[model samples]
Target chain A: MAISGGAKGILIFAALALLALALAGFITGAIGAAFVDKFSGDENVVHGWTGDVLPLDQPAVHLAPQYVFGDHAGDSLDYDNKEAKKYDDSSKIFNDNSFVITNTILSSLVTSGVLIFLFVLGTARMSVVPGRLQGLLESLVEGLLGFIESVMGAGKGRGVFPLIATIFLFVAFNAWLALIPIYQSFGVIEDGHLKATFLRPAGTDLNMPLALALISFFFVEILGIRAHGIGYFGEFFRFGNLLRGRILTGLIDVFVGLLEGISHLVRVVSFTFRLFGNMTAGEILLLVSSFLVAFLFSVPFYGLELLVGLIQAVIFAGLTVVFAAIAVAPHEAEEH
Target chain B: MADLGFHWPSLLVFLVNFGILLAVLYYFGYKRILAMLDQRSASIRDSLSEADRVRQESTQAREELEAQLGEARRAGQQVLEEARQAAERYREEEQARARAEAEDFLRRARTQIEQERNQAIEQVREHFADLAITAAERVIDRSLDRDAHRDLIERALSESAEAQRN
Candidate 1:
């Protein structure tokens, strides 16, 4: 059945949300288990390992450092610290060090590297009569640029088009990476239990999302300042009445500035969380659905996951563009 | 278990992850993609403008060619008309010359005929006068009386005069 654009958008959003939740759950579970283990007398509480590693006979309990990775043989790769002690668990891999580098970070790095390489190679070989790869890349870039130009106005849109397009690709690729079987496997257990492994959503990971938000935030302010100079800061301090009769208005301006400042702070948190929550939730949903019904039932959900990844990426990029446009644009002179 | 509360480590992990993601994307993905897009768009604009210029030039050339063709056609027509007029003038002049020559020939023939007629009349008169004198001399040689000769002479004179008058 042909899906409408809105339906497709919703489906994608839902998938991303599910993924975000799943990742968040895994992280929270690990962290919560670690903290609880610190207080509780349970021996497993300190190691913080959960999921399939916990025997079915024993109810899983929260522990300190809820996940562990590497083995005593020192053969395993430890993300947090290469020097961390290793122990031989069922799969010769012990401890969950997935959160140390953060699965989201690793995935983003991989996705970005691949995408940039493709983009550069494609561009280098572009021709009027394009080869297959060149043609595909050109069309994709052109189409995206056209869309941005339409929304942002031709003159300004061209400036931010690349930034927005890149964000879309990065987020989309990372989301797809999360759906891969290897990432979902976490660890293989000899006893027939699967340990939940990586818990990073490239966008949903608070560090990545917050940092992106902050960059956008900083640039927005900077652009505003550049455009308006001293006047841009005046929106915050509002000390225009130091000389004379405008004291009352200055005080009011200060209040307005304060409010604006608060909103800017909120922007950082909100932008970060919005992406993080959506992506984490989507991951969780997909995981639960698959766990309940196995691989066959999860097939349709994978399509949903693909759509969700795309939408989340678009939404993130779109928001960035909007914020950038607003920040850079000179504030209208206050209409008295 | 105590009611679940806010987890600081999770928050820290989230912050750390967000930081790395932003760094990677900003450097590798965003910057590069943006550069590529800008280059692509500029090229497209250049192509469109070039097309517009070529179209304008072609139109101008077509118009110029049409103008030249029109001028050539007008010149040819003018030349053809001048030639026709010259031919007509030449024909009229030839016809006039022929008519004048015919008139001159007719006038000369008429003058020649008049002169020839006058000469023939003079010759005939001389011959008649000579024949009359010979006849008178023969009559005188036959002899007769003075009064009879005088009467005969008067009758001859009167008859000669009458013959001359007829």
Candidate 2:
């Protein structure tokens, strides 16, 4: 019997979601394996910022399908000293770990390379009347620039377009790249363990997301400073103003200022996790769906992932714009 | 949880990569396009403004032309009216001149006719007297003296004049 469109759509969605779940589970495994050492060593190999290490003889939570992680289990047993079992429980965060290359660095370089290639291709022969590729690039850039201007009035918005535009495009492309079937699936099997996913989503890693977030954060703060001299901090630290002014209003000002400062700091974390969580979740959903069903059945979920990827990028870029606008005009914000 | 791992090498690489991307996109792509777009917009605005100015000037020129046309028409009508009045005055002056000349000519002709008529009357009367005297001379045939006859003739003349007067 011929399947209805609805059934096909459902199958596709199910395939994508299952693929995301499976890939997400694999990311967990891969991270788990990163912590596990192949041979015994007296000094604990500092894997990342987290100093905590688990003896990998046995894993606490073996993620969804057990087979993909089975290779690591065998490797750990072969070397008895370093038990190869540790599963990540903490979500993505960025902290200073003395520079050691990770999969994220490789993925990021690849993503940037692709972006650079596209930029060169798009801007190769710039013309007033754009061709197809140029037109598409312009539309995306102009469309995004218009959105930023809308959020932050046209006059003030122009200065911050580079940061917001770059972040949006980079994050969006990274997210979309993750959706490709071979992105997380294709890897070299070394001693029964999958090694080196050739092209991973940069946003999926904590480093890239955090790095992007920091860029946005600093850009917003610096813009604020540049716009409103050193006095810009007066918006945050109102204790002196409180002492000099009416008690009630001053107290309110102080409290509001502190809250604003806290919110400003919180944005870094917010920006980081927002991109990280969104891309990671989409990656997981896609990975799980692909693992669960055929590629043909993952079409609907692929569409959904595309939409999610776009939304995440927009949201990330949008927040940065809003924050920047607010930072520039703090007095206006407080009045409201 | 696997995502929380921060590798500095990766982060540094990411920062540099993105930084390069921003510079490229900003300089080569976004900035260039924006400049072009701005130029296009400025050109459009200039064209629109130029068109507006030309339209305003044309409108003013048309109004001026209409005013001049109306003034010229009024001047033409005035000239025509002046010509008609001048023609009427000239005709009247010529008629008055002709009438005066005709009256003088008529008066002179009437005087001449009166003079001729008076002359003719005197001639006829003198001739009649001559004829009567002659006839009387033939009838009398020297029977009376010259002085006596002359007296008689005078008497006859007086009598005749009396008869004629009566």
Candidate 3:
């Protein structure tokens, strides 16, 4: 019963959170656009040092040379302005700072890769008398598996654990990645002081979650087909029952199928936006809160940001599981 | 609005990142951890079954030993009782034989005494007879008279001859 309740709560909370996050993403994007426009003129001004150009017609430039590189001529020479040009061009393509090799990307890749590796290794060695690492991984997976099985009714949950676990790891790593001071130093020189800038969180970047969501959508349909065969395809058209006596039920089934398809499409959008909004909002909130009190008074909000990061990660993964479960469930089997 | 350009390298990097993550998880986390867990569970089960087998064998051996001991004790008691009975029977038979032998010796001694007594009586009788004969002969010689003395001698000589022949 606890398992069922937890599954239900996770599903419901994840769905609601995803919707809220989508709305928030839209709002933040709009607000951020406005904020950027409002503050565009207040860009920090720095002493730009120019040196010899490479064959690619790129000039070596350095910003706040004392902070990034010590006051050494060799350090200034080492700065590759071509890398900056590449970043500048990529940033233009995304219409945001997403394509740049920002701190968020590095942290996300490192943290997620490390965590997934450890978890998989631990699970591979799973035992009743497991070693410390294996035991921890087993317990975590078992808890999730038990919860999913209880809700989806045993045997029904196993097919989706891999997807769910992947989503969990990805979102968790990305969420935590956003918390680091990745964007705290990103800036463009306009006036005199160093003003901070931000790049989109890894999961918030649409491409990541969209790719995941599309994969989930494809598999869900595939599983339904495999489970029910051509009859599953009949869900979309479903005219045979109409030729028989059950016209109303057939129509209802068709309508429901259409609605389900629409929801599947919306899930991709929602899943992407949800992760994006949560991470972005947390990042923005931390930035703004810290700005309000300089730095000292914003310490407590960092704790809040950490909590939010964890919750958002859990919410994203939980929703992915729920969707995957619904997609693969033998709901059509009941009709038969 | 400034047009943003596409960079292929960043996209490639992203793909690479995803690939690496998937590979690492597949190799390190999934394979190794699951194998370890299976190994641990198997070992635990093996230990438990081994212990159970040993326990059963020990119990069986103890029961067999107890049964053998009980049989040995019963056999020992039987042997002890048999020896005691045999000793008692032998003692009784020897005692009965000794009592019979003692009775036979007493009867023989009685018979011998009777024979001796009879022999002595016979001897005594013979001597008396002889003495009487001698006395009569002496009287007749001394007094020698005629016809009356001759008759007394004849009678005494006949009596003495008869006693000597007996």
Candidate 4:
């Protein structure tokens, strides 16, 4: 709380130096270079000022994760160059040789590994009176279970908790992990540029979200069917009124059922795109901000991305819970 | 769809990855944590009920002890009251017996004194008669009839005794 004059002066000097570095970063960035070029009519202001340093290149975004390591990694495949007869039409992108591990897949494995390691370490020695790690894990698990139970009611929530909680933890951890500085900087560098980063957020890859979406879809539908028996399909097919000699109302019910069916299927797309879009946008925002102004400017956006990660995780898991709750709830069979 | 990066292998890998994670986590984490939580809550409930039972038992025991003490105190007081009454009765009986004995002794002593006084009075009357005869004979100094003197003295004494009695 108390500082001598010299320490205070040093603190002030450090603060000023940090500000000066931030200003220098802004001045050397693309916008500053453009401003200089516009004002002084210098065609290559960036080249003149930074001398050998190239301006930040546009961020390369791949919808499919690049195969950085395992099985045919860095192997350029030319269909025409392959044995003309052996390369069959059925085997387009994937053959025996094409089952390579992508960067996103590797990242997913890492994320899963981290989760496993944490769980193993936390549960190695468990007691009613928990130590720090166990206490933390217990509280986190309890909170997640409580949230699920709040939506699904107490006894039934435990059934779907593992899947829901996993989805949330996977998505959130992937986003947050990718935000680490090393994820951007430490990678296989090729020709003085990054060829592929070893770690990328799995949510940015379409397959990851698609996989999770499909899982959630199956989970909800299966639970619904299990709870209501074969009668669950009756929700999508309304022939009760048709049998009762009410053609007009029956047709309306049919149309509504059709809409309901379509909406249910559409949840998969919505789930996939929502996570993919936000994650991609956050990654781009971070990339662009750091490119535009190197250091201090992107800090706030990083904080925002943290919030975004948590929100997306919650939305994904929370929606699954709500959908599951609705699925198992009793249908209005008495409307007839 | 291809341009948007729909790859089958990646999807399969992700699904498999998630499945394994779920299995491992269920075994190692959620199941144990939930069980521990339930156990803790159960133990707490049991302890609370146990404490309540103990308190009730202690209160009951205290009440019983107090009741026993009161009964003992009451019994002691009753015994003391009975003893005091018995002692009072015994003292009165002793006083009554002593007073009766003393009165009986006084009556017997009064009868004996009355008998002794009668005897002494008889002896004194005998002595006085003898002395009167001696004095009469000395004054006369003349010989008289023994049987007639004896009869006269007896008659005189008898007449005097009768007069005294009247």
Q: Count clashing residue pairs per candidate.
A: 54, 25, 29, 0
Error of 4 at B65 (Å): 2.7
lDDT of 2 by residue, A1-336 (tens): 899999999999999988886554433342433444332442323222122342222112111111112323212111222234343311212222223334455566666667778867887887777888878887887798799989888766678888899888888888787777666665445643454454567776776888888899899889889989988888788887568878888888899889989988999898888887777776677655543332434577899989998898889999889888887875766566
**RMSD for each of the candidates:** 11.8, 12.3, 15.4, 8.0
Judged by TM-score relative to the true structure, which candidate is superior, 2 or 3? 2
lDDT of 4 by residue, A1-336 (tens): 999999999999999999998987777666655555542433322432552465444456665566675443422222223335433322243545555567788889988998988888998888989999999999989899999999999888889999999998888888888888886565555555666777778888888999999999999999999999999889889888988999999999898889889999999999999998999889888877876676788899999999999999999999999999999988863244
Window of ten residues with lowest summed lDDT in model 2 chain A:
A58-67
- DockQ score of the complex predicted as candidate 4: 0.33
Name the lDDT value of residue A309 in candidate 2. 86
The better candidate by DockQ, 1 or 2, is: 2
Worst 10 residues of 1 chain A by lDDT: A57-66
Off by over 4 Å in 4: A1-14, A35-48, A51-55, A70-98, A333-336, B87-166
Q: In model 3, where do residues sit more than 4 Å from their true spots? A: A1-104, A116-160, A180-200, A245-247, A294-300, A326-328, A332-336, B1-16, B88-166
**By lDDT, is 3 or 4 better?**
4
Deviation from truth (RMSD, Å), model 4: 8.0
Q: Estimate each model's TM-score.
A: 0.62, 0.65, 0.59, 0.78
Give the number of the best model, judged by TM-score: 4
Q: What interface RMSD does each of the candidate structures achieve?
A: 8.9, 6.8, 7.5, 3.4
Cα deviation in Å at residue A65, candidate 1? 11
Error of 2 at A185 (Å): 6.8
Deviation of model 1 at A170, angstroms:
2.0
lDDT value for model 4: 0.80
